[model samples]
Target: MSPRPDTAARQQPSPSSPPSDRVRRFTRAERWVHRTTAALMGVCVATAACLYLPEFAELVGRRDLVVRLHEWAGLLLPLPLLAGLASRALRADLGRLNRFGPHDGTWLREALRGRRGPAGKFNAGQKIYASWLAGATLVMLGTGLVMWFTHLTPLMWRTSATFVHDWLALTLGVVLAGHIGMALRDPESRTGLRTGTVDRAWAEREHELWRP
Candidate 1:
């Protein structure tokens, strides 16, 4: 016997699957800013190598072009972050980077003891990296400008800027190497950067305090 229309409709099995258990980790604009910043930094590093290292200089050739590229890339390094301010997500994350909680201190101690601790969106290490890099980049920009525009500063000031710029570039290279190594070791972090989302389970596990 056929049931009434309302009864049949109620008895029909659900068709769609459950929603995905993923949380947004990075917004599209945030990812774009990161990618653009990395690319410009890479250009600066590569061109710096060409200008400073004899082997790379010989291999690449065209001294004038390399210098121009390096200078322009360095000059444009901050544009991506400035443009990304249009994104609310990016603005919120920047605030997270600036704040250090009591939990961050606990997280660091537990990390030293080979244990995991609850962490918010930006952990202690990440916060330190972000803050340090921001200051370093500004210093680099200031020193680089002085070096480029010879008439902008006195001879003594230019010499000091050159000294600081060279050493800072080398230090930045080492820090970047460590950062890349750590990122490569964590596939989940790479996935977050790539897809702008992370598994809810992974977030709850790794960032117990940050499950959204």
Candidate 2:
């Protein structure tokens, strides 16, 4: 017999999602965590441009303020996620992000062929993206710290950190733009992120492995 789908963890009913046809895709806590992280990242990127790009820097004369904001935002980037550890729903979803099962492989193959396939609460690509994002966040944080406190790090490491931090910031901006574009293009995903629930039919069609 085939293994069953992971059971849905229900929460307080959302007014935006009708009871008969909606499925809980993200909990309120999960959405808040995502929102907080996005906001912090945006600030970091915006201030980074102000500090690093000459043209952008010309538009803003407050170098100290920009540096302070960027540094603090980078430092606090992980707070929401850490605080979210108190959320059972977020913990469960994080576990899902950590694993790749058979359906994920099949889904990835079909995706490469330009067709959709069965996916769980998170798809294979999403799993990979999440992993990459987590790793990148940590690396950026470490590099940012080294760059910030120049006295502690060796000159060579400081130079290396600056190089990594700059290039990684550029790469993250591109990746985040793609992520935002994809989210905006998918109404169901946008709605789910905003309201913490999605149409059951949409979930059934797109995330079949997540359904019972």
**lDDT (tens digit, per residue) of candidate 1 on 1-212:** 98999999887754442227777799889999999999999999999989899999999999999999999999999999999999999999999899999999998999899898769997888999999999999999999999999987999999999999999999998999899998998888888898888888888888888856
Which candidate leads in TM-score?
2
- Which pairs of residues collide in model 1? none
Worst 10 residues of 1 by lDDT: 11-20
Each candidate's number of clashing pairs is 0, 0
For residue 68, model 1's alpha carbon misses the true position, in angstroms, by 0.7
Q: What C-alpha lDDT values do all the predictions have? A: 0.91, 0.91
Badly placed stretches (over 4 Å) of model 2 are 1-18
User: How much lDDT does candidate 1 score?
Assistant: 0.91
Ten-residue segment with the worst summed lDDT in candidate 2? 2-11
Regions of model 1 farther than 4 Å from truth: 1-19
For candidate 2, the per-residue lDDT at 156 reads 100
Candidate 2 per-residue lDDT over residues 1-212, each given as its tens digit: 64445423244454565587787788889999999999999999999889889999999979999999999999999999999999999999999999999999999999999999889999998999899999999999999999999999899999999999999999999998989898888899899999888889989988988963
